[model samples]
Target: MKSNSHFSNSPFGKQKANKDKANSLKNLLPPLPLFILQPLLNHIVSSVAKKHPELFNRLGDSANKVFLIDPSDLPLFLILQPNPLNPTLKAYNQNEIIEHDTYICGTFATLMQMIDAQSDSDALFFNREIRVSGDSEAMVALRNALDDMEGSLAKDVAKSFGVLSKPVLLAMQKFSKNSGKENG
Candidate 1:
């Protein structure tokens, strides 16, 4: 019998599937109020803070400044700042234009790659794949702090889930490798 794998694997089919997934995500992530979102962001940041105190400490002055992250594919930006009274971080939003002091703009995948250390910050900035504006000094400090990390933040985050961390990480790795092979 002849194989019909070619049909399901067609480029048009793949494009449509990707578009559908994107639409679904967009629908799911509709603008959320900061009050409702604060706890979740705090929890995630607290977990990271516990794992790496030095990282936050190294942020030092930079932590005092508000850093805005704009995911190119999303409608809103994320504002991150280290809590003044504690080591925890807080995320919130404000009006569109000048609400933020600095901006880190990039696609979600690009952000993930940065966190995973799969790509170099200098190269990404040079290629214009990621853009930073306003408060270049603070941005540099933030970048340096991230570059100094001992391991992938993505992996660290996965491992935060207790016993399922390993399995979840392995599955993510396998999926990433397989997807790369498929696209390449």
Candidate 2:
């Protein structure tokens, strides 16, 4: 039998790659205190929500649901309440437990794929690349809302920081393209 370890397409190999990628990313991302990160998260979320009010239109009743967005490779978790009138997104340490109506777990790249609308969420879910738990209704509604939205949230997020972010975004884009990794 062929060794699964050598084939990047295999689960074992993919897990190892993800682990290496996570280590590389964690080193680059500063270990900022949650207090500092909280305000940043709040501002970004507020900016995104305000800039794209239509994102919550398909949410309907599910707009009230609390969502825990966990990037498995990261040390922080984001709890989001997609209320159009009063949206809130807060960050918490990975060790902290919080109440949420729905939970979506995936790697940073996987979540980026969703944000960029580069992948079909259902395919990702079926492929076991992304995991969803808790209220299925809310998950579906949220996915629908994301699907209905135009433009990438990533660009909007970068724009939220004003002119200063544009160069950084461009540089990151250049690096990602040259990173050799498929999802970079």
Candidate 3:
């Protein structure tokens, strides 16, 4: 019998295999320390708030409301409660769905792209690439806030890494470009 295993061992196949392995590794990671992550999250949000106060300003009463940002492709979720006084981030295991006023669900790439302002929020929502539930007001406010922001959150986020930021960002962009290519 001619071996059909050759196709399974091709470059595209290997890429898929690597992606599967990465997903598995991510699944195996232990629950991270919320306290350690909170400060970092706060800093990012604070930076954004400083740059565009209007976003948070629009939040009004909903500023204190907890919003769940769930990435459908990952085994984790993030809870964000925007506070003019103190913004914080709380991460949870996939199964630990907590009560929240608003929930924004999307693939990891879609969420990242949305946060980065790399794509149109309305288009993504209309295309069904993103799903929202619960508080529509809070969702609109948050989306508008992010959308109205002038700079790239992805760039700001990378800069948070200090010296390693450039290299990391480059690698990520290259990886994204490579992975996005169609395999013939």
Q: In order, what lDDT does every prediction score? A: 0.61, 0.70, 0.67
How would you encode candidate 3's per-residue C-alpha lDDT over 84-170 as one tens digit per residue?
Answer: 787767676654525566667776667777877887878988998887766677788888767777777767766777898898678
| Residue ranges of candidate 3 with Cα displaced over 4 Å | 1-39, 171-184
Q: Give TM per candidate.
A: 0.66, 0.74, 0.70
| Stronger candidate by TM-score (2 vs 3) | 2
Number of the top TM-score candidate: 2
Candidate 2, position 131, lDDT? 78
Q: How many residue pairs in model 3 have overlapping backbones?
A: 0
Which of the numbered candidates is closest to the native, going by highest lDDT? 2
| Residue range with the least summed lDDT across 10 consecutive positions in model 2 | 1-10
Residue 97 of model 2 has an lDDT of 41
lDDT of 1 at 75: 43
Give lDDT for model 2.
0.70
Q: In every candidate, how many clashes are there?
A: 0, 0, 0
Better of 2 and 3 by lDDT: 2
